[model samples]
Target chain A: MKSRVWLRWFVVTIGLAAVIHVAVVWLVPVVIMRVFMSRVAAQYGVNRVITQPLPTDLSRTVVKPSPDLLYGVCVFDVSAGPVRLSIMPPTTYWSLSLFDTNTDNFFTFNANDLKVSTADLMLGSAGDSGDAAARFPSARFVVTPHNKGVMLARLLVLDKTNMDEALAAQKSIQCNAIKRGS
Target chain B: MMTWVAKAIGVLVVAAAIAIGSAWAVLLHYPLQTDIANGSWRTSLAVGSTSADPYTRARVALTGLFALNPSEAIYFSANVDNAGRPLRTHCTYVIDGKPFVAQWWSITAYADDNFLIPNPANRFSFNMGNVPTGTDGRYRIVASSAEQTGNWLPTGTGGRGLILTLRLYNASPEILRQLSSIELPSIKLAGSCP
Candidate 1:
């Protein structure tokens, strides 16, 4: 009888351990992203473009930051309404990437992907039911999975010679919340 | 009855410990399941993608948050050199390569904590535009703690572990499809270490 009791406890312990392991694994990314988004939104507010300076040894906001690129970050929340993003990409290599709360990069586009000089994009969710396409016919509608996320713009500053141009392009990045309807 | 209660409490504590410990170990030490190895460098196509498994997502969140999807950029990292030796800060290395088949490319060095190493020069990376190439159209970058003549990427002081990340932005489809077969920069150790 004592042996059977011990076996039962062992099985219970193993099962509980497995459950905890899976929970920790799944929750790690969600928690990390939440902290990052909260920190950025608190400092810069939502739906506003903040151009970061060139990364050096003192730049510890993120890990493995590239010194050759200028970063523009927009922490967005679309629970209230959709957000509009407009940017004039520089002639050099540039890209805009969207990451969800789970740290998944859902949508991204580079300068070569754009046919025009500027890009106008609308970020919305499925619940944002409207003819956004018809309302803003010129803008491309990008549906995000999460209500809150981040939009990162990376502009390559090849050398000191083109730093001025890159800074100008970074300043042109804009993210604003759009009111419901016209 | 008192003994049984004590035994139950012990079992719960052990289970929690085992679970948390194993989870952190796997996330921190294990390599990604989808990693593609080319020499000493490794990259994962699922990095920063929706399709990444749970472990991969967690690892990226901890080490490289806000990473771009492989479609937009491919990040290849090397903790070892060409001879399969761990990169050390005190040692000198020579990185030789040609231009990558991408719109832009760069190589940046990081310390073991995944941050830029502190150096007086304030230099942390070498890109195609900044690095001068040779007559044969190939560029060489000397990574060392001490100053070198041309194209010097400081490794900082102290003997910390070094990590090199090569970013290929807008890489050609062919290169992405054949990532394992593509040619990457060769990191060869130079001179003896102290």
Candidate 2:
């Protein structure tokens, strides 16, 4: 009887361990993204573009930051409504990337993808109403998997000579929440 | 009855510990399931993609959050040298390569903690626009703790493991399609280490 009881306990332990392992693995990314989004929202607020200077050893805002690129970040939440992003593409190599709450890079476009100098984009939740599309006909509507996510603009700074130009280009990037029915 | 209850509680504790430990070990130490190894470097097309597996998503979130999709940029990282040796901060390395088929490219060295190594020169990376190439259109970057004459990438004074990340922005279609077969920089140890 004791041996049978011990075997049963062992089986239960293994089953519980498997359950915990899967749960932890699945939750790790979601938890990390949540914490990161919260921090970004706290420091920079949601639906606002903030240009960060070139990353150095001193910059710990993000891990593994590239020193050769200037970063512009926007933490966005579309629960209230859709958010609009406007970017002035720099002449040099530049790209804009959008990441969802799960840290997935769902959408991205570079300067080559743009026909004009400026890119106007509207980010809405996947289940959101399509009324905003007709309202903002000029803006390209992008449906995000999650209501909360991030938009990152990267401008390559070739050298010290072009730092000012990169800064100016990043400064012109704007992200704001679209009011309902307006 | 009391002894049985105590044993059951112990078993539960051990099970929970094993679960957490194994999960963290896989996430932190083990390589991703879809990693493509080329020379000493490794990359994954699933990085920052919605179709990534659970472990890949967790690893990317921990190490490289907000990374662009492979179409926009491809990230290759090497923690070892050409001879299959761990890259140490105390050792000097020479990275030699030809121009990449991309709009822009750069190589940056970071410590094991995934942060830029603090150095006196404040130099962190060398990009295509900054690195001077040879007459043959090849570039050689000397990564060392002590500053070298030309194309010196500081490795900082900390005696830790070194990680080198190569970023290819706007890579050509051919390069993206054949990522594993592409030619990458060769990292050679410069001299004998102490």
Candidate 3:
């Protein structure tokens, strides 16, 4: 009986020691990772303060996007339909471009080329439009069977001024290719 | 009877001491670092403007001895240290076999302070996608500022630095419970910028 009791005690002691060993190894890393992520969040938050008023026309800035940080840009190609490009505001910087399927070249940034700036579409002949995409009806492109696999690249530009806002805007960007119905 | 009891007590004391000693030893081996220079891995760079976050302050404070959790995904935001301080990048990562989620993963490069490097080719990312694995199915990525044909990510120029991210998604939760056993990539300075 006494021997059995001693054996049980031995097992308990070993188990306790093992628990402590695993905790030290595992808990340290969890703490460290948290520290790293929290630091990033804080850093991004501070960056928003220094850059208050963003440039209305970013074309002239040394850094077009100020602090150009492109997180993820995926090119989605669709066939036999019109692709819809959507944008959500509260972003430090945001833009999208359309690419031709045949040549694989960028067609336009915000519905305009260098020769014609689409920024004026909403204002009519006055060139004082509010939304570039909504103003120009010709901005939307239709792909036929021959032009299958037309592509669009969504650019998620985040600068120091609006890191959190940009990160949040990620969920808002979506794309849908329109098809003909009966 | 009294002698037997005394002997049992003595054994218990020894056992308790051993347990405490073991715990102390394991804790001592924990991934703890004081500063970045004393072997703390450089996860990312910062330039132009420093972070105002307390966590960033702590990271910058501990410039050495940052032990990474190999099984989990780690993220970093970097920037050039100085106006034209060139930052070099290099890493060698390994993946395990089995039905593990992250049997394959990637390491991408961003310019100083976490922006995509402006390359005319639009080839800013470098990862396992470029490196063809052997029959064994293991992968590796080499990040650098220099222009190389295979798995090379440019740092824009020698003047500014770049940020590197190592992502091990869908990792085995079980293996991650034991960080030391899992193998991780080794990031170091390959050379200085021109």
Best lDDT goes to which candidate? 1
lDDT of 1 by residue, B114-162 (tens): 8999998999999988999999989999999999999999999999899
**Would candidate 1 be rated incorrect, acceptable, medium or high by CAPRI criteria?**
medium
Q: Which of 1 and 3 is the better model by lDDT? A: 1
- Note the DockQ of each predicted structure: 0.76, 0.75, 0.04
CAPRI-style grade of the A/B interface in model 3: incorrect
Candidate 1: the clashing residue pairs are none
Model 3 / residue B35 / CA error / Å: 11
Q: After superposition, how far is residue A120 of candidate 3 from its true place, in Å?
A: 38
Task: Please write out the lDDT profile of model 3 over residues A89-168, one tens digit for every residue.
Answer: 43222334332222122232332222332221111111212232343354444222223221222222322445566555
List where candidate 2 sits over 4 angstroms from the true fold: A1-4, A126-129, B1-5
lDDT of 1 at A49: 91
Return the TM-score for each candidate structure: 0.94, 0.95, 0.31
Estimate, for each residue in A14-91, the C-alpha lDDT of model 1 and write its tens digit.
999999899988998899889888998889899999898888888898778899989999999888788998888888
What is candidate 2's CA lDDT for residue A121? 87
Sliding window of 10 residues with minimal summed lDDT for model 1 chain B? B24-33
| lDDT winner, 1 or 2 | 1
